[model samples]
Target chain A: MSVPTSTPELLRASVEQFYARHMQLLDDGDAEAWAETFTEDGLFALPGRPEPTRGRAALAEGARRAHTERLASHETHRHWHGMLDIRPQDDGSVHVRCYALVVATPRGGEPRLHRSCVCRDVLVPAGSQWQVRSRRVTRDGF
Target chain B: MSVPTSTPELLRASVEQFYARHMQLLDDGDAEAWAETFTEDGLFALPGRPEPTRGRAALAEGARRAHTERLASHETHRHWHGMLDIRPQDDGSVHVRCYALVVATPRGGEPRLHRSCVCRDVLVPAGSQWQVRSRRVTRDGF
Candidate 1:
């Protein structure tokens, strides 16, 4: 795909679309596809974790584990992201900060809030699309 | 405020910012302020409601009622919007469709998902910012 010249609105829309697709993949339990949204050596840092999960393989493994847990618990999860602050960097990367809410519903049960988090991500242009270079998620009230 | 020439990226960012402020005002129980985010004669349609809510005064009243109910229930509500599909019209209005999730947390209790809804709005320029000309919300399962 050819890279299009991005205006600020276009870039914002693209980033939002990227997150929509990425989160949906994760929610659908497609760990491999979700992991592919990141760069080959992407870094993911979670709250209270000493070492960040690095690389696509590790990322996929981590997502797989979470998917398994949700399955065993008989729940479906949805990741909702909002209130994005996007900044274009001089190094051809975009920095985004947003609120992410995880909603989980058990079979035949009402939906509940699993987590509220603030997510920070660095996205780099990969071919025509963008890929996550690094992401750090800090849970609310943590 | 001077209206800046909007690129697609700028428009997207502006819309996101609009919702951030709009939803915050509503969640914070600022009914008048939240109602002002809409046009003076804005229309709001909700699921199972035969007639849409019309005008800012009525809108404020509705919001005030919701706030009162929440206060009585000792719960706080946050509206999270995601997966926005925005279209800029030739007439200077924008059409935005998004998923909106309402998460409610009672004092000293865990957060729960109050509602999952799809929201559609037509936003028109009001001064340098945008205001909702009309909005329709449909609950996910209703």
Candidate 2:
């Protein structure tokens, strides 16, 4: 297998683009690809929730669960992302953060902001692809 | 005058350090330094607030106003920033985004998380230091 590339600018751009695509895949209802974005032992945590979703299998299950229930049926969902920041770490890992908002539109109704959070992520090089090592979603609280 | 350095890593590091120092100055009550971090035409804006604080002088005045009333005299304020991401634009300006939390602790009371926001900044190269060209604060919404 070829060694993973670690250029800072490339890594930052790639990770960000990967995230952009990840959200798109979710909206497209591609559960497998969405889960593949994470490492085998990746972890995901949500604010105000005690238990975390861990590992690629669990991550995929979570994605499929949401995708099937939300986008595949009557309700339409769109993920909006902005304020993306990525840092290439000295050890070759990349730290990433961004703002995300989920808009849900009823079958024949207006759209509303269903949920929003700041995502803190750690990405590691996986061959030519970057995979999430861990992700934490900090929910917006007033 | 030196051409504004455009290397991605260097510019990002400089901007993050500048932001860190900017926060330190506010906590330290060094109003002059805090204000000088902005360009002559710097602007600061907040959500739900229509008007923006424009120009270095106005920026300084706003900083001093907050510092004197909250930090410099009575309560102690602490600003913490993380998830900093800087993008070096082709025009020699850099775009920055990060998460910030402000904690205020009374003389002998508990530290409270007073306010939190995601800061979006546009920084321009100014000699050896990066100056804030524009900053917008979006308060966290539940």
Candidate 3:
């Protein structure tokens, strides 16, 4: 389990590329692409009092709500992500953890911290891209 | 980028082990180990309406309070984790996403959901053990 730090760096560039693509999809309000990031049976979870819901479609619905309903008029919504870890799987997929900060600027509204998510993701190579198989966004606090 | 399915399975097992150790530390009330699971400058965040606090010491203090003050007993606390995805990190760490359900059976009280988290975690391999560099837990609304 103890890998040389260099190993992670080897995948850094590609991971960053995937991460960038993910961010772009969100920032552009491309829910379809965002949902396509994961596999069909992929789970998108938001854990807390309501309990987490599974499946890609459910996750897509959540994303749609966040992008349109929450920030309908936000001309500028930026999300920054840093991958804390990316592990290669035996099936050629990768498991990754990423830290994120989402800043939303809604016309007259002050720039606010809309959400911060720690993404735990499973990615499979789809064509030349890494697509998500399952993802969980664990929100902190009650 | 084009890894096979087996990769996810291996990564899942590794992540499960990491969570098992983490839950053990909490249930056993092993504060040091619990804290040690984080990096020296790790962020144990509790995401909320407001931004979350960062760093290990803060996380340790929070954990202590939850273990002692928030709950009446830790004897019947059960942590069930599901749907985890693992990611490899730049510094020999792994990023993970999983759903957690903590049900506590207090003495003379109905079992309650003490904590339900969509855990986003970064785990670095320190020697042979995995340590958390960042954990962002987000709470869900009804």
Where does candidate 2 chain A have its weakest 10-residue lDDT segment? A1-10
Q: Each model's C-alpha lDDT?
A: 0.86, 0.73, 0.63
Candidate 1, true inter-chain contacts retained: 0.32
Per-residue C-alpha lDDT of model 1 across residues A55-133, encoded as one tens digit per residue? 9999999999999998898877878888899999888899999998887777666677789999999999888778999
Top-lDDT candidate index: 1
Residue lDDT tens for model 3, A85-106 = 8888776778888786555555
lDDT of 3 by residue, B16-57 (tens): 666888888886667667777777887766755265545667
**Candidate 3 - CAPRI tier?**
incorrect
- Candidate 1: tens digits of C-alpha lDDT, residues B37-88: 9999999999889899999999999999999999999999999888776778
Displacement of residue A5 (Cα, Å) in model 1 is: 7.5
Q: List the candidates ranked by lDDT, beginning with the highest.
A: 1, 2, 3
Ranking by TM-score: 1, 2, 3
- Residue-level lDDT tens digits of model 2 in B1-142: 1333556554554454466567767766788788888898889997886799999788778788887798444676656677887677878887879898765656544445677899899988788777889999988872
Interface RMSD (Å) of model 1? Answer: 3.2
